[model samples]
Target: MAQVKLSAAGERFFGTNVTPRSFEQWIAFLRLELKKTQRKRITASHNLHSIYLRHNNPDMAEFYARADDCFIDGMPVRRLFELFSSNAGFNHRFTLMDNLPQFLMAAQREKWRIYYLGSTEHVAQKSLERIRREYPNLDMHLHHGYIKDNAAVVDNINKHSPDILLLGMGMPLQERWLLENFEQLEFGWVVQAGATLDYFTGEQAKPPRWLSAAGLGWLYRLAHDPRRLARRYLFEPWWLIAPIYRHWRLQRQENGTPRT
Candidate 1:
């Protein structure tokens, strides 16, 4: 079946977004593409408050929107997709906490090697230690994140040539880094996982399981760090949510559904 697509204010998302199926399909596609890959990539949609993000951070939002494939990772987006599909359940639904494990499992099963990039050397070190603790058999060669000079980072990445590269640095910078440098790297797939290392290394906590499952992960995050997140959740919707609501409503009207 064709994926139901929604384009809201110049951004796009699927109608039935399942994390695992999307990821697994990504792997299958990447495996094929990587065989001919002079440069191929994968990126996740950690958060794009859509219009707000674009208006406020046009550079980052544009770069992210341009990725070869962008998976919607959070519950808000997943549910946004689920709105159009009945079964809506696909096996691989994991956050970065879950994504890394899936990747590790894939590496173990297929013997694919990974390179860890981004974050401080200390965070990188601690991340490797923790992953080893969790998945003892997984193989990873680590590199410290985005060397100040792009040329050198590309050179080193080309040399290592791992199967997958996980980037922990935040958006636009990370996306730009990959877009500019991915041509030189040998990795089959590159995933941008914002603050993924921090979460893995116990530096940050994900929303509690209940909150996440209930699609209140944003609420949980807002509760945990209101000082930082509140501004985003509040003022951002004026630019982001408002536009999406208009689009979703337009979608409903186009479908001839009764207005709520």
Candidate 2:
């Protein structure tokens, strides 16, 4: 419920505000925010797929624009920031699966309440069991993403009154849910987490850290689940070409530099 002041130092890339914050810094900021009672804070992260969605979908665009803070969620987006922006500090990319353990540790230490809404019932239960084995003291809740009634789910979330809400219902659906029910939700921090719980449940293979760091995570994922990810990893990036070029041109104009 507290208003945590995240660093406003960031650049706008392809209509998304990219705030680059390290994992440790984010944990610290979450801890600091969890200590107070203020207003609900919505946080989002962007990859190529999300960026493409934001560009093509009005609802997705509204979600990103309304986010209190947005950060780079993929290496490709980070690389684009490095290439297009004047700032050299856009090196941080935070993925939920990569940082969830550390965040859960912080939650346990701080006694912060967490509610995760996504994944199937089986996967959610499996993930809960696994997390309990690792951090038994952590107070966490889970709900399946298949909703029969939106009002009921929102009511359940409000009753829990968790400090952090991890929504992993996938892209536009998750974003749309938040946009529609944001006012009714009472959580302190709402994070747009996608398929992160599935990784924990072994429903999806998480790429190695090295591969992700090297900007080949998408390839690994595509190889693993080509049916689900082929368009996103292989073809969707092509959709960004014109937008990236336009952004580059605008940046050059702003700097009073000659057009390429």
Candidate 3:
């Protein structure tokens, strides 16, 4: 199925399409589409500011562009849609944490075998325990993000052959890894879930809904892990302005308006 293109919003965010689908819509799409097409390869990449870094890295950016399904997982990117799209009413942000319960329920109902990759061994174990507590019948496997041997990792995934693969090893790396191994992965959906595993294990907590709604979730993350996220949360968002402006310029040019 073709991704419903988001209009008024630019066709591309940097180099990737700003394909905005709500949380409910995303679940529905997954259920319907995956049921219909078994060979369909779908990648769900979220947390928008990472796109700036992806933009700088051509390979990663191309993977984001090629994803069969893309959802806006960060607020700043939602705000950008509001700023740039005439039909912005449909855009909404849902983090990985916000999405997990419904997603797991659906996966359980659909009988999808899942593989969880990324995060430390402790976090991965704790996350699986929590998941099993909540979803007793969730057919899933876990592997810590520390594994460096790409071939071995691919071998393990192929051995199990999960219907869905959740890669939560954080941005660029997770996306890059997914793309690099895309050919070898015979799975339903490969999701790039940054810190979802940590959230599951209570190793990290998301900012309050208010902060996320106010587009300050990045700030909360920065406060919690300053040493790691400070540069990403502080500097990466600023990079979006250039692409947004470029989109605006293209829109104006298309409408027969003179450049300022």
Candidate 4:
């Protein structure tokens, strides 16, 4: 388990060590994993700033910390790391949109099959159409996110044995599902992609580059889905204050300086 040991700043911002890899590097790693001869699994996940800010939920924090590979999915988290973690080389934040095309291209070139699992049945179908329209050469499969039988899902996945599984079933749910079924699943790469399917299906519109760069994408999302995201953006993020201070104290101690 490679832990990102940049410093307490990295930990405080992410609740764990986030692998500070750029989009190209991340795709390269996935390509290498696809080429590997082993039948083992390769897991990758992304965490939003809300994950680190969720101080009240120890389980969530621990899950993020223990993910085999974690990337920054929220621009705010990346911006915060850039501001506070001077030693961290995390200048760019790569969302599902940034990585999906590259991944699909790699999968196409290598003739790797893909299984997309997420979104409603309708949205999943729409996404399938979109993928076919855009990436006509890409071989892919699909499963809706409204899963009722966990064992059945596992069995189905094992039966198909796709090279990569891109799961868009939100955060903690996807993480927990992978934790329970990963050992039995037969995918080379399992990527937790949150609402990527929604974006693909045009159910959720992509935020403008300016808004995303300014770290206001959450606010834009909140403006759209207030009922669902108000608490996450407005209240949950307040929990980050405690960890930010704690990180500062640790830095002071490491520098052998007295706290003023």
- The runs of at least 3 residues in candidate 4 whose Cα sits more than 4 Å from the true structure, single-residue gaps closed, are 1-15, 38-50, 84-88, 256-260
- Tens digit of per-residue lDDT, candidate 4, span 110-183: 78888888879998898788778888888898888899987887888778788888887876677667766767
Residue pairs in collision within model 3: none
Give the C-alpha lDDT of model 3: 0.73
Q: Candidate 4 clash total?
A: 0
Tens digit per residue, CA lDDT, model 3, 1-260 = 44443323324444555567766666666666677656537566456556676768876767766776666787777776666655547676677776677788878977888888999999988878888899998888889999879789889988878878888888678877887788887777777777787876678867877887787877887898899887787777677677667877876776732121
Tens-digit lDDT string for candidate 2 (25-104): 67767777677787598778888999899989999999888877777888888887778766565467778888788888
Candidate ranking (TM-score, best to worst): 2, 3, 4, 1
TM-score of 4: 0.82
Alpha carbon lDDT at 53, candidate 3: 67
Report RMSD for candidate 3: 4.1
Find the candidate with the highest lDDT and give its number: 2
- Candidates' lDDT values, in order? 0.61, 0.83, 0.73, 0.67
TM match of model 2 to true structure:
0.92
The lDDT, on a scale of 0 to 1, for candidate 2 is: 0.83
Residue 151 displacement (Å), model 2:
2.1
* Candidate 2 lDDT trough over 10 residues, lowest sum: 1-10
Query: Which regions of candidate 3 fall more than 4 Å away from where they truly are?
Result: 1-11, 38-40, 256-260
Off by over 4 Å in 2: 1-8, 256-260
TM-score of each: 0.74, 0.92, 0.87, 0.82
